[model samples]
Target: MKRSVIPREFFCRYTPEVASDLVGCRLVRVIRGRRISGIVVETEAYRGPKDPASHAYRGKTSRNGVMFGPPGHAYVYFTMGMHFCLNVTTEPTGTPGAVLLRAIEPEEGIAVMVKNRGPIAVDRLASGPGNLTKALGIGKELDGEDLVMSDRIFLEHGRMAREIGTSPRVGVSAGRSTRWRFFERGNRFVSRGRPSSPQNP
Candidate 1:
């Protein structure tokens, strides 16, 4: 069976509603003659300008302008003096929203990922957003790339062997009321930084 490249083709239908479903999916990178795969374990949703924590909250600028573009685009950004994070642009052409890829568990090309992240263990090579981006060689140059068609970075489907967990996002003082972080339930690779929801995390 030729599965669609984007397992969640209609992912934009609900804005941040189903961003959690992205957990457990695989993100593939074909870089420099090597193919690497990572199992998505953590994610966060940025709900348009109204949400204070969103980068697009201040309106579209050259930095976040891509988020205003159509869905399926990569709206990656750099932060904390030296870290790059990946986000899947969401909503319509004029809406600025996205789902943040917080962490992943490397499955393929582990050696390459380790090389990128330095002598880290295969399991901890891409445990957090910064760590994962570092392990994947994802940087500002790859910003604005289209997730649906990018040869360097893309996503795949799998029968995730765990439950989908829910929680509030981490590292943001604002928009704390909205529970926008999601992860693979019981997955050891999941981020431990976020606060768990009463229902689950």
Candidate 2:
């Protein structure tokens, strides 16, 4: 079947809208000549300076500069000094916004994902942001990559999720009350993470 790559226009909109719409899309990563892919099952929207939990909330930095770039780009970041998380830039240029890819249902390369994630269950291979990156071989080196143009990493059209659930983002303190997290209900590949507690005054 011919692949339908998602267009940049799809991401040049409100961050929350893009985040919700991203559920069920296919995220593909090509490492060497092998293709690894999965159906996006969970996402979290971070609305730039307006979202205190966002990396761009404090203004653009070298690490978050990709968030302020054109839409449909990868904004991969290293976190906890150990893992990498993948995000897709949203909104127009100068507008800092992104949709963090929280989880995915592994698709194209199961054996490779198993090798990458060790002896984990298939459903848990890409069940969280960090593991999703690891399963697909995503890292900081792919940061700022133009998803619309890059053959190495890109998104493709997939069946739209039938039941999408929304809740506050996970592991965030300041934006704990915002229902920006979107996930496919009943998806085993979705992360089971709960929201972090609100920050102290």
Q: Which candidate has the highest lDDT of all?
A: 2
lDDT of 1 by residue, 1-201 (tens): 775468335556555664776776788888887888887888889967689998889887899998888888888799999999988888778877788888888788988887888895666788778888888888988888888877788887745647777766788999989878887777777667734534352
Clashing pairs in 1: none
Q: List the candidate 1 regions with Cα displacement exceeding 4 Å.
A: 1-3, 194-201
Backbone-clash count (model 1)? 0
Across 63-90, the per-residue lDDT of candidate 2 in tens digits comes to 9999999999999999999999999999
Error of 2 at 110 (Å): 0.6
Residue pairs in clash, model 2? none
Task: Give Cα-based local distance difference scores for all models.
Answer: 0.79, 0.91
What would the TM-score be for candidate 2 when compared with the true structure?
0.94
After superposition, which runs of candidate 2 have C-alpha atoms over 4 Å from their true positions?
A: 1-3, 195-201
When summed lDDT is taken over every stretch of 10 residues in candidate 2, the lowest stretch is 192-201
Give the best candidate by TM-score: 2
